[model samples]
Structures are given as C-alpha cells and as structure tokens.
Target chain A: MQQPIAILDSGVGGLTVAKEVMRQLPREKIIYFGDTARTPYGPRPAQEVIRFTQEIVDYLLKFSPKMIVIACNTATAFALETIRSRVSIPVIGVVHPGARAAINRTQSGYIGVIGTEGTVNSGAYEQALKQLSPHVDVVSVACPRFVPLVERGNFRSEETYNTVNESLAGLRSTRIDTLILGCTHYPFLAETISDVMGGQIALISSAEETARDISTILHDKGKLARGDLLPVHQFCCSGDPQMFKMIAQQWLNEQIELTPIVWQVPHIG
Target chain B: MQQPIAILDSGVGGLTVAKEVMRQLPREKIIYFGDTARTPYGPRPAQEVIRFTQEIVDYLLKFSPKMIVIACNTATAFALETIRSRVSIPVIGVVHPGARAAINRTQSGYIGVIGTEGTVNSGAYEQALKQLSPHVDVVSVACPRFVPLVERGNFRSEETYNTVNESLAGLRSTRIDTLILGCTHYPFLAETISDVMGGQIALISSAEETARDISTILHDKGKLARGDLLPVHQFCCSGDPQMFKMIAQQWLNEQIELTPIVWQVPHIG
Candidate 1:
C-alpha cells in the first residue's frame, strides 16, 4: 500500500491545498482531516489553536502517512513547531512556503500579506520572510471577516467583493508589488480579491505555493509516488457532513470518500 | 564558517543559478566553478560529459559544501544520478526544477523545451515532466547554436536576434502555453526568445526554478543560513579568467572574487 500524505486544517480552508495536491501530484494518495465543528481557529487563542491542531494531527497519524501538511495558516502559525518536534516524518507548514514564494515574486522588496487574526498576530509571515531574506519589507493585515465568508461558500458574491475590496483598501495605498494570500481560505475568494487588487499587484496563493514546495521536498527525498494507477484519496470532517461534501465536491470537481468522525470526548467539539 | 552551496556548469551558464541564489537566499554562501576550458558540453558524448562533471564534483568536494547543484542542463541530463550516488550531500539538478515549474505554470497540457544537443537528445526534460505528470505533451528541440552565442557574450546583437528567431521558428507553430528554458544560458537570451515566442507562452527559467528548489530543500533539512551577515561568494574557471570575470560581474551586477584554476593534469583541460 502506498503511504499517503496527511493534511489537516481548522476547517475546509485546507481543501484549497488538497485540491492543488490532487492536481500537482495525481498519483500520490491523500488523507485529509477538517475540524469544521470547531471552524475558524483564527480568533481563538494560540494555545487553543495548537490543541485543536494537535487533535486533528493525532487523528490523521493513524494512517502512518509519509508526510504531514499543516494546511491552515492559523494552525501552521500556532502548532507547526510543536507538531514538528513530535512527528518523525516531514511536517510542512503553509506559512514558510507562502513567504518564500512572495520573496521570489516581489520586485519592489515590499510584500503584503492578508491572513487570519491568529496568523497575523503570530507574525509568522514576517518572521519567515525576514529569516529567508532580511532586507524584505513586510506588511501584514488580519482579515477576521474573510474566513466566515469562505466558510459559508460565498466566494464571488457581492458581499465577498465588498469585504475583499474594503479589507484590501489599506494595501492598495501601499506600493507592494506582491500580495500573499496568507490564509488558505483566501484562495476561495481569489477572483474577488484579484478584481479589487487589479493587475499590477500579483497575488501569491499559499495553497498553490505549498503544493509546489511539497513536490520539491518529496522529489528531493526520492519519495514521490510512482505508478500508472491513480491512488484513491480519503477525507474526514468533524462537522455537518452534507455541507462539507457539497463544498468539497464543488471545489474538487470530483467525488471523494468522506468519513465524518464523531468526537469521542464531547468537551473538545 | 558557513558552508557554501557548490554550483558547477560547463561554462558561465551556471551563473544564472548563482545570481538567483544570491537574490533569494542572501545569507547563504556560494562557491561556483565554470569549466570554460572545455565549454559547451552540449554536443559532447554522454560519457565525456559525465566524466567532466565528476571531475568538477571531486574538485568541489574539497570545500565540504552543504549541497551540490549541477546547474548545467547538459551535465544534469548526463551526470546528475552519477554525482548524486557518489556524494552524500543534497545534489540538485536544473532539469527537474524546470520540469516542475513548467508543470506548475502550464494551463495547457502542451509544453515546449529548448536545450542543447545533449540535453534534448537525452530526453531528460520529457522524462522528468512525464514522470511528474503523465498526461503532459512535450515538444523538445535541440538548439545547438544558442550556447556559443551566449558564451561569446553576444547577447543582443542583430546577428543574435536572427539566430534566435530562426532557431525558434519551429516552436512558434506549436500550441504550447509554457516553454522551459532548458539551458541555463538561455536566460541570457530571454529577451530575444520572448520577443519571438510572444506573451502567450510563459518561459520557465531552469536557473530561477533551481534556486527556489535549493531554498525549499535546504529549509526542509533545517540547513538554511541564519544571522544578518552577508555572504561573500567565490568563483573559479578553468579557461580565460578575464572573460569569465567580465561576464560574471556584468550578469551578477556586483564585483565577485574569482580564482583562475590551473589544471594539474593536461588531459582534462
């Protein structure tokens, strides 16, 4: 049996990453977990977010995956290092990949980042960017409203356009040549964001960049899956199965096997 | 002492990769080698190219670099696996990175590759791309004359434009949406190539993509350089140091320390 790449998120935001992985590495199997019952870890305290992420990772680890991807920006911000220390396999976070890509794409040395409250508060993008190239200038904003908009599947609605336009108004005044969609959920509203940001500023999707990093790291380790047969993928969600299935099917454009998990400990959910 | 990333090429082509590494990972040190004495490994036999690459690897090993980058497409096509097996360090090649980037950029399944005689003949890009995504349609062309023009530092001459236009006349007929600049030297003539191919096709630079992979792989291994100290890079060439220095400074946009190598054995040079 081929070992799968396990991915986890606060909620369906990670589906953005999962979709890219499916497109980029079609042969690799995936086991994904979305804690939709406790969705939007953005406003939660760092410790709580870490605990929630740990619970999801523990659930995903049962499959003995080759690699673990922390696909949500908030979870990656709070729990990535904690999980990295505990896991034996490679644990990738969304923040650094997005930061590296922004550094690669930015021409003015000025980069703008929009993420959840937790990710922006943790200053992960800023730290990651400065760590890679110290001279880079980073502008970060927390979009607390964006996640709820994405969770409801209101991607290109007029409400989304208004929210995106107003949210990015501060950035437009700045001279940033590249804007990193620091939150995975942000990609869901990318078209609206692009319409507001216009053509001059390039948007860097963390989901797409994370998938590219996954390819690079896997290829480097000589661990990329190989075979003519396509591997079947499995997904799990801790929430309303109907809504998760609807959103996932629409976004992935394919049928997927989803296993809804009931929390054994009622206190967590 | 910060261990440098050792990069080698048949000639000045590898400087493109080195320049990107400098821009993306400013803290990391680099030691580069150019076998200008026996330049243009494109038309050489596979065995001869492998032997020359192995020699450069043996020479570079003395520095105990953190990683080795075979920055020439011809050498990467011929000798990457041979060098990887011999060395314990992470060995990066230009071929896979370019292929990966092309896979990421191509909206259309059809991809174009232009390389030297050896790289194109070896079918390395086709193999890499097909290995990653089996459905991609690859159109490969061997541009044997492009390298000599670059080596002579004849970048934008009228003669260069005609040569580039005539060489890529065949590719213009294809419906490929993405073209991989399979040769590292090709980026030097990117303007002419882009002018010929037009904006509909995206040009994937192996040099830039290789640097991105270097960053990803190094970060994954927890080997990225830290602290604010700028790294001083070193360069060496087997042939005319004057010409090499001139091209290196002009391309890199900074003064670099160059050491001319005198071959101990007459057979190699």
Candidate 2:
C-alpha cells in the first residue's frame, strides 16, 4: 500500500492543496496531475464536471494510488460523492476541511466563503458549516476567475490587488470575522485577501486541514509512507510547459521538474 | 476588398484593443477570437506561443479578414515577426503602438513598461523605444499574471492591488513619469495601477493607439467597411464556454454568446 498518492485537478489551482499534503506526508511520493487541457470546472454544468472528474480519477487510478484527493473546489463539490462511492481506496474532498476550519476560526459565528461559481452553488460549504455548527451564519460569493488569476502568477500587480479588492467588496460588507478561501488556488492570494479584510477578519485556507485529513485517512488504512526524508514531488500539466513551470516556481516557491503526462481523458461519469 | 478584421488573443485581454478599434473604425466588422482554453500566453515560451498563435491565426483566416491585430502583448512580442512575415494580410502588433503611447504620455524622461514575462523578455518595448528615441530611460517590469488577474474579474482586491504595488515598486521608485499598460488586459486595472504609481505618474494604454493604427491601415488599404450599420463582432475561444463567457461579460461589461473553436496548440513559437 505504499503506492503514490494520486491528486488530480482541472489545472494548477489544485497544486496548493497537493503541496500541503506533500509537506505533511514527507515519506510519501505525490503524483500530481493537472488536466490543463480543459480546465475550469467552475462554470461548467454539473454533469460535465461529474464526467470530467470521473475521467481524471479513473486515469489516476491507473497509477495504483493508495488514496485520492480532489483538490479542486469545483470537482470536489460536483463529483466528490460519486467518486468516493465508486473508488475502493479512500477519497478526500476539500470542502469539509475548509468548512471545519471556518467554524473553528470564527468567534462571531459568521463565516464567508469565496470560491468559483460551481463551488458556491453546490452549497457544500454551507451544508458542511451547518452540520458542524448549526448556529453559524454562512455567506458565499462565487469568484469564477480567481483560479486562472493565481495560476497566471499575477498576484503581485496593482491590477491584481485592485481586482482582489473589487472582487471582495461584496464580501467585506457582510462583516464576517472569518473568510474561508474555499478554493485551493486562492491561498496564493491570501496576502491580498488579508490586506483587504484588514486585521478584523481571518482568512482561513483549507490546505493544512486537507493535509491533515489525508494523513488521518492514510494512517488509518496503513498506507502511510512513514519516513523522515523529503519526498520527491512530480508535477504534470497539460498546458504550456514553460508557463506551468514558471507558475510552479512562483506559487509553489520551489523548483519542480515539470513533465508533460498525456492521458486520454475518457468521457465517462 | 472590404472584409472583417481579425483580432486574436490567448484570452479576453485583446478586447480592450478591439473595443478601441471599434470606436475608431465604426464601419468595420471584427472577427474576435480569444483562445481562453489556453489564455495568458505571457509566461509561456516563445516556441509554444508561435504554435498557439499560428493555430488561432489559421482559424481566424477562415473568415478571410482583410488584416489581423495581434492585440495581446505577449503574442505581439514573441510571434509578431513570424506571424507578420507569414501572413498575406498586414499584421499589426500592440508593442509598437503601446511604445509610441508610452513615449507620448511621459512628461519626464523616465517611462515604465509592465506586461507579461514573454513581452518583457522579448525586449520589444526597449527595442522599439530605442529605435524611436535612444535617450529615453525605459524601465520595464513583468507583471506576469495581471492579465489573468483581470480576466478573473478580481479587479478591485486589496491583495491584487498590493501585488501590483510590489511588482511595480522597482519601476515606481525610479520616478517614472509615465507607465505603459503594455498588455491589452491591463487597462481594466488602470485605476489600481494609477493609484499605485501615485496621482503624478501618467498611465498610457495601447488600446487607443491600436485602434488608430487599425483605422489608418484599413483606410490606407481601401478595405474599410462602409455602411451606416456597424459590423457584427463574433467571439470565439478554445476553452470552457461558460467560464470564458464569465470573463467576456465581466470585461466587456456586457453579455456575449461565444462559439467554441477547438485548436491543436502544438507549441508557442
């Protein structure tokens, strides 16, 4: 059961979640597959996402993974249930972890969730929050383009910060003390998100929580690659190798030998 | 000889240029193509961009445009020479026009250029400016993800603004009297960029210059569409239609119906 952990995304947005998982589980090797070919499950119809997620999970299963993490917020919302039910190994979704973090961090009992349209629409966050603390008020805003923004590595520009400010204006007025960056790619914008929200609000990222969940599941299953050595991480993207490499360096803050992996995406649900 | 004009980009960044071209050339119809499936060509390698640009140009050629506008800064920098030389119709790059605007707008000798990494790496602005006036001190910085930041409609985030502040800190400290929004998508962040540079430094966008160039070229070639009614604008992309539509609406500030145009992007150069 020492097979590599398989994590898949529609694009590089999921790398944040995968990177955290890699950090927590240093003994295990991670096989990160970014389907940069047809990304952005945020705005697509639910059925299409279900089909796309199933295809990638099915593709990753060929690597004989010990466990799978749906790091993408949209896919986690749309396809997590189906994938978890069908897969033999443990399947983890990011939404619950994000919800738990928000509930823990919020002292005011008000939490804000900002993510892609599909993620916000799925009500996954709301449902998770309510189940954890039925008294907590949840606010969700869909920022469909944030993933591409972070993936493009534009987090440093005045325009990017301004966009973050403008994008969060609606959420700011809500007076939520804790804001959950519900999408994995969004952690890249934490600095800007925090600056806009100022000291009054907390910006919660699911990266660490998701990582913990991965460890818990793998430990329980006797699949933990227990070791002290730093794990070798492989990043594969279907988009331009150079662009992927540059973003991989900036966002991941480390050099990665990015290889192109060609997997025939099966059109199945 | 009257025919539609073709404008192609990796994404909706080109629309600012197209919008300006529309203002100046009211009678001409535009065949606008956004390769949102592979948007944000800034960080990609030149070779891959050439391939992507070539494929999109080939697709746009099916409409038989009288001329083409490489409205994307990254594309203009990397593929202009190859694309212009290969295509039968005239090809206009945004660099020359943007550089011209930067020179014209600067009251002081110091001017700054901000765009995608590919554009900054091509040294297109420095070369163009030196050609125009060697004495002008041009400071160039690569705001790699600004376009995608804009595309994601994250236009007013404080974090996005802070990133802008940090990325441009080098250029702004040099006491740049003027800055060029070298990429078409940058204008959407004009307010943020302007604020970061302080109220003193003037900012220039290439959109107007490109529009004027299109007008001059069309008028000179005797291919200007002459009719009381404006020409129809068609939008196309290589990626998810729903998300692309989200970007188009947010950027264009209007609803749009985009047709999916599948492309095989072998490489960029």
Model no. 2, DockQ: 0.01
lDDT of 2 by residue, B1-269 (tens): 34788998888788888776654455677888887767779889999998888888987898899889998988988998898779888888788766655654465768888988988999998977664444578889999868878767788899789878888888856978888888888988889898888888887787766765565445334465656564567788776767777877766666676654344433322
Best by DockQ: 1
Fnat per predicted structure, each in turn: 0.66, 0.00
Docking class of 1: medium
All DockQ scores = 0.79, 0.01
How would you encode candidate 1's per-residue C-alpha lDDT over A1-269 as one tens digit per residue?
A: 89999988877899999999987788889998888889999999999989888877787788899999999999999999999999899999999989888988989999999999899999999999999999899999889999888788789888888998888899999989999999999899988888998988899999999998999989888899888898899988888777888888989999987864544523456
For residues A110-196, write the lDDT of model 2, one tens digit per residue: 899999999999898997676444568888998876777876777767987888888888987886999889988898888888888
Cα shift from native, residue A141, model 2 (Å): 0.9
| lDDT for model 2 | 0.76
